[model samples]
Target: MAGPGEFELIREYFSSRFQTGAQAGGVDSGVVLGIGDDCALLTPPRGKMLATSVDTLVADVHFPASADPYRIASRALRVNLSDLAGMNAEPLWFTLALTLPESNAAWLEPFARGLADTARLYGITLIGGDTTKGPLSITVQVTGSCDRALRRDGASAGDHIFVSNQLGAAAAALPIVLEEYEPSEVQQQQADAAFYFPEPQLELARSIGACASAGLDISDGLLADLAHICEASGLGADLKLDTFPIAELAQSMSADAALETALTGGDDYQLCFTVPAKYLDHLQGLQLPITAVGRMREARGIDCFLGGKPWQPRGTGYRHF
Candidate 1:
C-alpha cells in the first residue's frame, strides 16, 4: 500500500475545503484570489494599511507530536492571528505552508477541517501555499489591515502597561502534559483549555488602537514580551506583582511557582500594551477586562516590585536555542 500523492491529498483535504467570499456570503471581500492561484491577491480596504505576519510551528518544539491534529491546526492559525491583533489589524486572509512526513488521510482530514473552521470563524479566507515532504511543520502567513498600526516603539515613559486577560494557565498546563504533575480534574481542564484554545483578543485590540501606544501579544512570558516593548521604545517597566491578573490555575499553586509561571512560562497568547496615563480614563470606558499591571519608566530595563520592594523572578521565557 502506498500513501496518497500531493495533488490527491490536497484535493481531498485542503483545496476544496477553504471557503471563498462567495461561499461566506461575500464577507471575505478583501480576498481577490484564493487557493489554486500562483500567488494570492489581496486588496486592502480604502485608507487602511496592510499588516502581514508569518509564524511557524514545528512538531515537538511548538506542540507535542502526539497532540490532536485539530487542536494543533487551530493553534497554528490562531497564533498568527494574534500577531495581527497586536497591530490592531482586522484579519483578511491567510496562506498555509504545510510539511508532512507522509500523506495520511486520517490525519489530514481533521487538520483541514480545523483550519477551515477557524478561518470561517474569523472571516478570513485561505489563499495559497505549498506542500512538501519533510518533518511535520506548519507555517501560516496572515494578512490584515488597519488604519494605524500599533507598534512596539510607540510607548512613552509615562504610559501605563496593560494586559488583556489572566496569565500563566497555559504555562501551568505543561507540567500536566509532561506527566510531571497530577492536577485536580478541574485544574487540568482549565489549564488544558488555555493551552489548546488561546484566544487572540482581536476585538480588544481594535478597541484599544486609538488609545494604546505600543503593544504585542503575550506568546512569550509577560516579562519577556514586555522587555521587547521597553527595548524598542528605549524605556523600562515596573510591574506591580500584586497587580498581575494571575490565572486561577496558577493562583492554585505556591506563590513562588505561580509567579515563576506567570513571568517565564510562555504560550499565554494575551495582548500586552501601553496606554498614555492621560488616556487611562478613556481606556476604562471601553469596559474590557484590561488590567493595569505596570508603568513604563525612563530606565532601560524591567523591574518587578512587590509591596514597594524589588522582587526577582526565576526565568525570563522560552528560547529557541
Candidate 2:
C-alpha cells in the first residue's frame, strides 16, 4: 500500500498546524501569507530590518541517525533559532524543507508535533517550504526582525568576551551517546538534556545587543566561535582558561578531559560575545548567567592561559571536512 501523498502529508502534518498567533483577517502577525502558497508574503515591522538565516541538518552528519524524531525536530528548529538570537533578532517565521527516505506517519507525526510545539514556543509561524524523497535531512530558513544586529566585526581591542550558561555539557554527552563511555544516571541525564534541548539565548540577546560589540552563537565550540569574532574584528583574545564555565556533566570527568571537552567539543548552542569594558556594570546588572571569560587584544590570534601560563587545547573543534 502507498503512503500519504505530498500535499496530503503537508495538509495533515504541517500546513495549518504551525500558524502564528495572527488572526485570519488581521495584520498583527506580520505574516500576510503562510504555508500552502507558492510564495510566502511577509511585512517587516516598520523601520526594522529583516534578519534571515538558513541551516541544514543531515542524519548522522548533524545528529544520530537513530535519534528520536521529536528530539531531531526540536534540535533542527532550535539551532536555527539560535542564529536569530545571535543577531539579536525577534523570530517571526520560518520555512522548512524536509527530505525523507520514505513517508512514514509514525515518524512524521512526532516530527510535525515537535516542530509545531517549538515554533509556538518561539513565536514563529511556518511560512512555506518543500518536501522530497531522499536521504533524511532538514533545512530550516528563519526570518526575524531587528533594529540593529550584533555583528562579528564590531569587537574592539579591550572589549571583554562573555559566554552564556555553562559549556561542554552536550560534548560530554557524546561519548555516552556513542556508547563509548558509561556515566552515572544523573550525569547521563544532564548531558543528554543539554544535547537534546539547547535553549537559544533570545532574551539575553535582546538585552546585550545594545552593549555587545560582537557576538555569535557557540554551535562550533566556544574557542572556535570566539576565533570568528577575533578574526572579523582584526583582534586577538586572551581567555582565562581557569575561568571557563564548565558544565556539571563535564565536571564529572577528569579536569583535563573536562577542559578539553569545553574547549574543543561542539554542539553547545550558547552565545559567545564581546562587550566594551565600559558596559561591564550594565552587563552585570542583567543578572543572566553570563561569564566574562576573556578580553579582546591587539594581537592577531587567540591565546589561552591557565594559571598565568599559555595553555593549548587538544583539538580546535568539529570540522565539516
Candidate 3:
C-alpha cells in the first residue's frame, strides 16, 4: 500500500487525536486561542510555574507494534504526566513528535481517541507537535506549571521512603507477550490492562505535595530508579524487597521470575518518593499508604533486605546496553 503524504497523514491520523477540544473555540476545543498558526498561543494562570519533561517511546523499546495503538498513545502521554506528578506540578500543555512508518486510519483513530481521553482526564492541552515519516516512535514533551515545584535534591537523611500502587505490572506482562506462559483470563486482563493503561498517579503526586521531599516515577524498575534519587539527594537507601507491593497474580509466577520482574523490570510508572518521618501521618492522611520499605542515610550505596537477608541485584534494570 502506498503511504499517504505528511499533511494527509496528520489530517487523518493526528489532527483530532489529542481531543484538546475542551480548551476550545480557538481551534478544536471551544477555547479562544489557536495553535494552528506558525506560533502557537497559550495563556496560563498567574503565579504558576512550569515544570517540563520529555520522554521518548521507541518501537520495540517502549511498546510492541502488535500492541493496541490506543494503549500506546495512552502510555506515552501518561508516562510524561507521571513525571509532572513526581514534581507535584499541575499539567498544562504537551507537545508530541510522532514518527510513523505509514498512515493507517484504523490505528490512528483509536490512538488519537485514547490520547484525547487521557489529556481530558488530566486537564492538559496539546498545543502543538510535529509529524514525520520514519520508524514508529513517539517523543512526548509535557509541561506542568505550578507555584511551587518539587525537586529530587530536597530529600534529606532520615526521610521515609514510600510508593504508590503496586509494582511490576509491566514486568508481569512480558511473559504473556513472549508466549512463555499463558495467563489465566483474569490474570491476563489484569496484567495487560495495567501494562497498557498505566495510571500515572498525577493526583496522588499532586496530593503528596509538600510531603514528598524527593520524588520520581518508577519507569526503569524500582531499585535502579530510586538509586537515581539516592545519588541526587546525596544519600543511600536500605530497601526491604519483601515489602514491595507485588500483585497476587504476579506472585504466582516462579520465584526468580517474580524477583526479576520486581527488581530488574521496568515500566511500572508508580511514584517512589521520600518524606520526613514526621510527615508520615501526612502521607497516611492522603490515603496513599506507603510501606516503610527503608530509610535514607547520609552514607552512600544501595542495599536491599529480602526475607531478613541481605540482597544485591546482579545487574541494573533495563539497560539498553
Per-residue CA lDDT of model 2 for 1-321, tens digit only, reads: 123576457554676566532342135558776765568777778988999999999998888878889888998999999999989999888889988887788888889988988887888878877887889999999989988798899999999999998888888777776666787889778866787778988998998999999999988888889989988999999999887888887886778778878877788888999999899999899898998889999998899899999988866322331
lDDT of 1 by residue, 91-118 (tens): 8878889888888888888899889888
| Between candidates 1 and 3, the lDDT winner | 1
Among all windows of 10 consecutive residues in model 1, the one with the lowest summed lDDT is 19-28
Query: What digit string (tens of lDDT, one per residue) describes model 3 on residues 174-230?
Result: 666555677789878877766777777777777887777888888888888888999
Residue pairs in clash, model 3: 21-29, 23-31, 24-29, 24-30, 24-31, 25-29, 25-30, 25-31, 26-31, 49-146
The top-ranked prediction according to lDDT is 2
TM-scores, all models, native as reference:
0.93, 0.93, 0.88
How much is the lDDT of residue 40 in candidate 3? 51
In candidate 2, which residue pairs clash? Answer: none
Question: Which regions of candidate 2 deviate over 4 angstroms?
Answer: 1-8, 20-27, 316-321
Rank ordering of all candidates by lDDT, starting from the highest: 2, 1, 3
